[model samples]
Target: MATALVTGGAGYVGTHTCVALMEAGWEVAVLDSLENSSSAAIDAVAEVVGRGLRLYVGDCRDNSAVERALTEAGPDAVLHFAGLKSVPDSVADPVRYYRHNLESTSVLLEAMARHGVRRIAFSSSAAVYGLCKELPVSETAATRPANPYGWTKLISEQMISDVVRSDPRWSASLLRYFNPVGAHPSGIIGEDPEGAPANLMPYLLQVAVGRRAELPLYGTDYPTPDGTALRDYIHVMDLAEGHRAALEALVSSAGQVHTYNLGTGRASSVRQVVAALREATGHPLPCREFKRRAGDVAELWADPRKALLELGWSADRTLAEMCRDAWAWQSAHPQGYRR
Candidate 1:
């Protein structure tokens, strides 16, 4: 019925969301650069859905590529998930992060406007909250990004919001995702981070699968009960379902921007996560605590009530489920998509 053009459809979140969208009865087309992602993820998506998705292997920042995808797909909406997403890497290379993240959104939004594709669900991050003032961060919390990565995401959110305001044709949802863990549950399609996995769940999965020696605890001296940094880790599939809900909402509304926090609204410390994974994977999941990382916070979760009350979506997967599903994919393909 409706076609959706997904940027970065081969990426960890994008791939899973593609499956969710397809299952929800949307014809999906992908435009990806495959910079840090693999084409095999798309193939896995096809396998999971039992159908082929048209893919444009190109960068979202390229106007020509964006136009080509928009013109050809004739999508009813665009799900933008293409960007460089690493905090340390962004700190090291602010210019690259700003250029890549900002340019891609600007270019894509311009192209979408040109083609009259007005509906978009953007993959924003919790990093936009920077150092949170409140315990359970809500969508209304103040945003003061501590690094370039977070700044880029915040700016992109504003850009989309501005577009929706400027043109009555555009309706948008900016989903500020917390830690997205777990796989598709099928173990067929999952997160496949390149080089070294940056986040917690993937790294733990690698450790369980024998890729890493141990899960290096980033900070264990925090003020939390477990003396470790805390996060709101949501399942990837639930995050996908959140996107589905947001997109469906946007389709029926116009001339507005809705921002939601896609998280479980509960914080889990690193020690707790490691213990859960140990039970799920049958690995000791040993860890060595390190000094607190710079810019590290004690805890940051979500006040996800707005999303539940508005979009009827909330993360339903538990920590054990996250570990189990993540281990399933990582164990099946230890080398990520390269396998």
Candidate 2:
């Protein structure tokens, strides 16, 4: 069987990707630090996939450890998902963010090159397009990251591009993901943030589950229809499947770095998301609308034609499905894996 190494494979997106890869007939090994994820999540993947996961608890920045992991897994490709992702946290500790996000990715790429692992699917973000004035941001949009977290991702994407350019034998797929929400429909795995959730879906889930008092609408003064920020929220499962497509594309292409934007191409405001959550959970959730948030864009979605054309992938899940699955996971695991 072919082998693949998934960095940060125990986290939300990474864990789901592991399941998708296993279903696609790839032997998978996960390397994670557990700083932002739980070992229980890894176990959940094992249970769902009906196979024990090869998990290594370590940092990606550790060059020797990365080398050993590649040597051990003998991965045919590396799904790069290991990085710090909180915008607020990145703002607070820019140095730490750069060290963990940018530096660690650099080390991982070096290790991959040294070990002759040429195929990679990097987990880039929409934040790399930072507050785009355009309505539907595409892969061709200018990359002006608004925060340090996004800056690190932009840097990492460039590094991957450069690596592929320098080595003709290396191939990579840079997948720029939009706002990824929802959870595995099975309710066994989901977005389980450690502290106060940075993203909207997790926060709304907390409110729906009565763990939090109310949802705080971060921006109510934007130029959008609801005067709030809008984002292209895609189901985590769809995002995971997109990873599989990207990996297949890179492996088949074999000579170029391809970029694709993964999203539903539909922008939903904060108010709209909250309303959908209330309907999905069948609860009276309170929402507190406030002033515009710092570093927030009025509207952002994706032009997924490229992905559809190239990878033959499009988000098949709906907003209702996203809310329903998230509600299922939140209601089932209120404390998220601790239960």
TM-score of each: 0.98, 0.98
Cα lDDT of model 1 overall?
0.92
Query: Of the candidates shown, which would achieve the greatest lDDT relative to the real structure?
Result: 1
- What's the CA RMSD for each of the models? 0.9, 1.1
Candidate 2 deviant stretches above 4 angstroms: none
Tens digits of per-residue lDDT for model 2 on 1-339?
888899999999999899888988989999998888989999999888889879988899998779889988899999999988999989999999999898788999999988999999999999899879886998998999999999998999889989989998999999999989998888888899988898889998988878899888877877889788889999999999999999988877767989899999998988888889989999888988777777777888999999999889999799999999998888989999856
* TM-score for candidate 2: 0.98
Cα RMSD (Å) between model 2 and the true structure? Answer: 1.1
**Model 2: lDDT to the true structure:** 0.90
Residue 178's lDDT within candidate 1 is: 94
Which pairs of residues have clashing backbones in candidate 2?
Answer: none
lDDT of each: 0.92, 0.90
Candidate 1, residues 1-339, lDDT tens digits: the string is 989999999999999999999999999999999998888889999999999999899999899999999999999999999999999999999999999999999999988888889999999999999999787898889999999999999999999999899998799999999999999888988888877888888888888888899877887778889799889999999999999999999988899899999999988999899899888889988788788888988999999999999998889899889988988887788888876
lDDT of 2 at 138: 88
